[model samples]
Target: MVLEKVVEILRNYKDEQDLEVTMASTFEELELDSLDTVELVMEIEEAFDTSIEMDGELQTIGDVVTLIEKAIA
Candidate 1:
């Protein structure tokens, strides 16, 4: 369900055909540049009303989803 929500957010910012978030998805494959990545993180935080930790391990959309799920849990 979180992945679906993340997909919706990505769809709003980028072409759906160009990106897809599965459990194994990656940021580079999703075509998110540094700025877009930061924007996404902020948006996710705001949308979920939770703080995602700023860490080096969050290097992909899948990583983000995991982080979000962990934070919310």
Candidate 2:
């Protein structure tokens, strides 16, 4: 459920349909820079109604999902 929502947000944010986004997908692979990452994080926070702090430890979509799950937990 969380992964689907996250992927939906990512696809919408990037305006990409054909690109396959999975847990293994990295932000760099999605062509997201630091500023873009911050904006995406904001979107995720708003969607999840929670807060997330980053110290550049995240690398893959799985990392993000884990972070979100931890934050919400």
Candidate 3:
């Protein structure tokens, strides 16, 4: 569920060159700035009905999936 929502959110920013975003993809690889990250977190929080505190440890899409899984668990 979390992965689907995250992919949906990511799709909103997809361009011709960025059609593929995988779990191993990092925010940097996506060219997401700090502001974009903040917005992404907000969207994720709203979708999952949970608050996610941003930490330095979250680097890849897999990290976000793990975080949401842990939160929802």
TM-score of model number 3: 0.85
lDDT of 3 at 69: 89
Candidate 1 segments whose C-alpha is farther than 4 A from its true place: 15-18
Candidate 3 error regions (>4 Å): 14-18
Candidate 1 per-residue lDDT over residues 7-47, each given as its tens digit: 88888878665555686777778777778888888888888
Candidate order by TM-score, decreasing, is 2, 3, 1
Give the runs in model 2 whose Cα sits over 4 Å from its true position.
Answer: none
Q: What is the lDDT of every predicted structure here?
A: 0.80, 0.88, 0.81
Q: For model 2, where is the 10-residue window of minimal lDDT? A: 10-19
Residue lDDT tens for model 3, 1-73? 7787788887785533445778898989988887888788788888899887697777888888888888889
* Model 3 residue 28 distance off true place after TM-score fit, in angstroms: 0.6
Residue lDDT tens for model 2, 2-71: 8888999998998986669999999999899989988998898899999887889878888888889998
RMSD of 3: 2.1
TM-score of each: 0.83, 0.92, 0.85
Once model 2 is optimally superposed onto the true structure by TM-score, how far is the C-alpha of residue 63 displaced, in angstroms?
1.0
For every candidate, C-alpha RMSD to the true structure in Å = 1.8, 1.0, 2.1
lDDT of 3: 0.81
